[model samples]
Target: MKNLNVKNFRDIKGYVNHEGLVMKARMIYRGGPLNGLSEKEKKLIEKDLNIKYILDFRDEQEAQLMPDCSFDNIVYERIGALIGSFKHQGFDFGNLLQGKMTEDKLHFLLDYIKDGYKHMAFDNPAYHRLFVLLLKNDGGVYFHCSAGKDRTGVAAFLIMMALDMNEEDAIQEYLLSNEYLKESNDTLCEQLQIPFELRKNVNLYSMFKKSLLI
Candidate 1:
């Protein structure tokens, strides 16, 4: 999971099929919102990578809030996975640090994420749409959510699974979010002026990543 010059862009590398064949590099990518890219990065994506398809997993409101930039002749598909319903509820770090909320609300939050991931991969109609896109697009396909973590990770997991990648490899790919987005997350927490302890308590990406193991 190497971070790209383009923000939050990652190559879905180091995963292998059952036959021990590594997934092709530059064929499939996952990323955060592409709207903040510079002109050079835009050309790198369009001209060099020739990324032909994008599956945007962000909800309508989130998409409107930070819409992706237009790539020349690229097909942008909005396959909202209903992750918007999993909004952030305020966290109580004092209760959490004291082990009060851990068994209750913290577990509840993690359970919600697990269920959401399962739903997105198995039951959501967007899954079928994603399949269709995969069938139609031969070139590189990039999928993203708000932070390119949970929703995008689920999409990557499902795709790797379909391509015959084993459970461990798929999970590794999913967990790469922590490594790839470390800088972005740090900047985000600093920008929001969130306390370090509270940040750890409310880290949805970390919670969600851990939940996928079970």
Candidate 2:
């Protein structure tokens, strides 16, 4: 992965697909919220990566709360995935994290997230639009959500599957966010007053793995 200094940024490349061909680099990238991108990071991506398209999956409120910086020559589209209700409304992740952070609560969260992934894969109009944009884009495409851990991660998983990547590899790529976003996740856990041990036991990777398989 090229270190572009963008927070939680990663290139979805170099993996072998089901057809036994290596995935192309610099075509697509995924990462955390670009709303707070630094001037340098913005220049780096805009100039070096030549990213022409950005598919934002954040909801209207979230987008208004912390919108991505407007860059010259880049086209951005906001198509939030359907977690519930209307197609325009985004997933209620904050509400989902409410209640005791116990093992059982963890299971419930995973179950909800798994079903959400299924919705994004098959039912979400935003994801359908993303698939079309990816196929049509001439340059690199950058896609993300607020943390780029849950919603954006699910989108990445679906893209991998669409490209005919192996199931395990696709899952592993999705799980890579555990490492790439660990620092931010830890900070968030602390801010939420969640104990380190409890956070450690959440096992989001395994939860998502099982969810996709099921």
Top candidate (TM-score): 2
Prediction 1 global C-alpha lDDT = 0.70
TM-score of each: 0.77, 0.85
All models, RMSD in angstroms: 4.9, 2.7
**Which ranges in model 1 have alpha carbons more than 4 Å from their true place?**
1-5, 83-108, 187-213
When summed lDDT is taken over every stretch of 10 residues in candidate 2, the lowest stretch is 84-93
Alpha-carbon lDDT, every model: 0.70, 0.76
Candidate 2, pairs of clashing residues: none
lDDT of 1 by residue, 39-156 (tens): 8877777777767888888777788878898987788988777632253421222233343333465566566656555455666666677777777757888888887877777788
Q: Residue 172: error of model 1 in Å?
A: 1.2
* TM-score for predicted model 2 compared with the true structure: 0.85
lDDT tens digits, residue span 1-214, model 2? 3545556788899988878998888888888667667788788888888788888888888888878889898899998766643233346556656655777877666666666655566677777877888889588899988767667777888888888899888888888888887887787776666666777655567657666667
Per-residue error for 151 in candidate 2, Å, reads 1.9
